[model samples]
Target: MGTLWYGGKVRTLVNEHDIQEAVFVESGIIIDVGSKELLTSKYSKVISNEVNLNGAVLYPGFVDSHLHMIGHGEKLLRLDLSDISSLVDLRETLIQHNRKLGQGEWLIGEGFNENLFNEMIPDKFFLDEILSEQPIVLTRVCRHALVTNSEGLRLAGIDESTLNPPGGVIVKEKGVPTGYLLDKAQDLVKGILPKIDRKYIKRALVTSLDDLYQHGFVGAHTEDLNYYRDPIGTLHTFYEVIDGESRKFRANLLVHHEVAEYIMQDQIEHDYVEKGSIKIFADGALGGRTALLSKPYTDAPSTNGLAIYSPEQLSQIVQKARKFNMPVAIHVIGDLALEYAIQAIEEHPVPSGKRDRLIHLQVTREDLIDRLKKLSVVLDIQPRFVASDFPWVEERLGEERLPYSFAWKRLLNAGLMCSGGSDAPIEPIDPILGIHAAVTRRKPENVGHPGYNSDEKLTLFEAIKLFTLGSAEAISNENKYGLIKAGYTADFTVLSEDLFELAPDEWLNVKVEKTVVDNTVMYERNKD
Candidate 1:
């Protein structure tokens, strides 16, 4: 006697236009979907409770194929520099945050983007004076760059003689550590403070669950559960806690690339809870200008982005992952990364195992797209990235490069399976906003400029498909969360308006009416 949901437009999304008026739910599973007269009559005896949806448009709850749970949750814990667009803005914010801190302790902050600032490069001198007497560390918006104060750099032993780590950068001016770090260089000073506590991670995990649930996400493949290599960092502790208890949400865990080889060899997959997948980064992001490229960046004519993995390293990984039944997901942001990823797949001819995926094909040439059609590849994209970078893209990558980057429409036309994701913490994990950006190819509120590769916009149906079925298919979870079919999970989202009919420009204005999971109202709008 769970519940019966009636009088709503329930779209199964298997067909392009299949919207029904009722759905039956019991034992956290969908029992039936049909007209109110049809379903109420079919499960009349089994339903002990019935709620009228009153014509709300119901869709399969979104499945974000890629997300970072612990990292996202801990965002609530740090100093927010989201508004630090200029040096003046940062100086003002940091000066204030430091005053609230205890003396001689670490004053950590995040969400600063160098590209957004007027100077484009903030040095240690700026940090030293603004918040004197405190060891300060601030991460770039991408988390790939970190700027620390003189005291902090001195504490970490980064001086004029310090050498940059492989796969990382230690920025310097005139041979002195400028207090900036890139990629692998983050390890130099992170040891100054201990990792976040286990209990805090547990709290973050539960909080992250409801946060995702409210956004119509019932499940996600957490791409890097232990990327920090600390075995803590909010991921390991939360994983242990969930293993000890029954949880409302389900998460598929992907081991870090560094640890996968050992785990695959040591009968480790069975040793951990919810471990059946893996994550790897092929290249960096366009924001960092390190994502490997076929041609040099237009802005920086001297160099193309760097590739993180060699062909041999990637091939060995391909072979290692095949021995286990787990899926593979690689982060390939630019064309060179895409090519390297494809080479691994092609050269090794990876076995047709379970859930082999190439994620974040964010920037690629037509030739690579042509080749992608040949491999066992899928798309796990951040539509909100389009929403976020609309104005900056042309300036960053140049107009000639804009057409192939974030090519949503072309991916659709190429008959590829694409799923929508927020890449939260990296982008705001707002599914409605992501969808709006996908359909409209414009920034939220259409304020700044049209999106890069605007021609790549998807139809309303296609956009929905990415968040639902396409995402489900990526992790082999489609049987449950992606469709409104009988036996699927009783998870659906209610929207204030039918999204298909809205003017493209107005899509960003769409609101969530409610989010339902396991036939229970998980989130509902407050009229006030």
Candidate 2:
């Protein structure tokens, strides 16, 4: 936990400052970020361990604003159908996965972005008949929708007469259900599945942390712990695993409003952890056409997206959280949901002293930008979506909606505090690839390699700030995390090459040379 160095071009994303040339570390914190000569003359002992980055780039390790612990672990253990296009491929992958599991055992899979599929929503009836013995639940790329084959649905007592949840819809065609569940409808069938135990969950969390480190993330906010058992216990588990091991984590955890309330009211106590913001859901995602759009879906006529909470209910929740001096972060994806969130927040009128966090601020009107600037709303966004979906965004939302979607460029110009996260399990959580997408606004996966609304792309410096400093500000940790100055945690990511000099396409292959957390090497690339 002392004396660290690398020869990379040091990037100090300091406030009101330019990038620094050199960096020095000691005692798990940045000692100095000035020229090399000054640092060398000061800390001369055991200088041989100086990492010869050889002109690579050093930047603040990613601070993923929104992430899940167990959900990401599901990616490693589940069937990864993200790249599988046709129904044939899906069946093939399932059949192959079934081979690895027992005949009657349950199989969980993740990452099937229907938007990227050629057939979009496939016939789940076929998938049900193919793997009837095992109950397989593969989530869509967007958390807003899920498809449960007939067998999985039938087991949960969902049939033709099954009514949809107030905030969700069970997509049924003819008298029978189509194995598709949108939004809260996912819980209908999911409730029937057996829960993972603490031991397995512990393993999953550890594995996910390892994956995040590989992507150059040193610390993160545990976003989905809101749904886990003893969300506080989840944080301690994460800290305990990281503490004893070489790979450590610096984390800010978001808990459900009820949980935060319990803690703040002195009803609960956990000395092992620190408090996190309150995470709440506003509406569904745009991919499933459930984003609570102001207008009806362009593709699916006659229906607007669903809202999870009415205005008054959301208002009360915000007001209550403010009384406890807790930051409340809400997820709003569609323009309508976005507007609804703003109105409720304004009506609730929390005193101006608390953090205002808006998760995924995906669809923004120009006026919303001004509102955010005035309200000081911290926007937690996903740039990978820009890279992956920009080519098809216009097709999905039409040219009109395209202008306001993923408005990173406009948000920055308006001087709104914005943070970047990959929304893993939904998007690849690689910070480098995420940065590339943020800058280029192009997804190589798409056929056209189109830059969707190119003017919305952010500059290199600005984008890096989102994954680092901007994220820190969201949780009110900017003074300690976002800077490389003395007393800041010596958390940094070293890439194989200088990112500023690389072509956009080269991002896909760029490897993590090292990831340091708490002034120690957490992840070092294999030297094969």
Candidate 3:
């Protein structure tokens, strides 16, 4: 028996203007797509169910090419400081939240951007005044830096005497620890946080997936093995959530390099979950001034940036992954980091069918783009970054580098494939918001403002392709997923309005009507 879906505008994505009236799905695979009359007549005998879209618009299911699944769930569970605009507000919020915590529990908060604060940076003195007796750790929005109280420093055995780890920093003033940790130094305190059990891991994965379904995401290529610190149990938890429970969501897991060998030894591909690539971090983030760059930051000239791995070290890691027939997905935010990543890939190339991914090519040059075009690689970009980091980012890179910073359209025009992501928990997880950022290239609030580098804006159709076809291609699943035509997986996202007709701003108000995966309705808007 098959399900027939009709009375909707279906964007096949085969071309810009290919719209079909109906689609038929059987056994979780699309069987046919054509005019309503033709599909209804052809599958009439075997049709067991019929779905009436009622003037909605349907497109290929959305997929996020990069995100931390468990981190998203943790953000939901922990105290969120993303909205605290000032230090006074943060102190008050933490004071209120501290009252609800159990004895000896660390007061953990995430997503604080000092850029919005009148007090340019956070210090331990302010936290000590609020709750000097207890330990607290507040992570920056970028997740590359954090500020903790004196108690937290004591618990982690970090002080002025402690030397900074390789590729990490402990911010200090006058030989005194200021409770700020950058890059890998964040692990010092995070490693000692109360260990989470399998129960917590399962809960986080389930919570994140449910949230994704509601947001119209059919699947995500996520990285989470490093956070949970239990490779086998975490992998099993993913299996239990997606396959055992029949959640009907697809997941392409990218195992971190630290745990790659363990995962590769026992990797199994199921209907809903599959291991994809080896995840590596070549450098830190721009916000933390840790992203390796060819030139010293224009704003801060003390140093260039932090490189997580040297050129030789990065090459060795890529070669190790290649030995197992696995592709490498390295995070590279600065041009220097991108150069290291490109050199490593050129030194140890993956198989022909597989593709290495360079995540967050935020700062790039024309020469690097030319070099990238010659390789078999995918650029996993977070479009929403433009909305969050704009005019302020200009100050960091200076005027000369503005042309290549966050150049999404330029990369596509250069004939390089780019997959879109929100980098959720850092940015919002909504795919519509991501598409809007790509199309408008500005924050929603800045209505009349001609976006920062308006020339880099993507067309509406091209932005949508980043979440659909481009994401599927990143995981090498384009053949069976990310399309509305026959022989594709029966995954669809139904929206209340036709995005093509509405402007990018209107997309923010559009509702997700239905999210279907494997011919099963996973989420539906409540009419009531």
Who wins the TM-score comparison? 3
Give me the runs in candidate 2 sitting further than 4 Å from their true place. 1-6, 15-21, 43-54, 228-232, 258-273, 349-353, 445-450, 526-528
Which residue runs does candidate 3 get wrong by more than 4 Å?
none
Instruction: Give the backbone clash total of model 3.
Output: 0
Model 1 whole-model lDDT (C-alpha atoms): 0.73
Clashes of each: 1, 0, 0
Instruction: In model 2, state the lDDT of residue 102.
Output: 69
What is candidate 2's lDDT per residue for 27-81, written digit by digit as tens?
A: 6668777767777776777354476667677778778887775678777766777
Model 1 clashing residue pairs (backbone): 409-456
Worst 10 residues of 3 by lDDT: 114-123
| RMSD of model 1 against the true structure | 2.9
- The digit string of per-residue lDDT tens for model 1 on 184-225 reads 777788766556566766776667776776666666667544
| Cα-based RMSD of candidate 3 | 1.2
How does each model score on TM-score?
0.91, 0.92, 0.98
- The lDDT values for all models are 0.73, 0.75, 0.90
lDDT of 3 at 523: 88
The predicted structure with the larger lDDT, 1 or 3, is 3
Summarize candidate 3's per-residue lDDT along 245-279 as a digit string, tens digits. 45888888998998988888874768888898999
Ranking by lDDT: 3, 2, 1
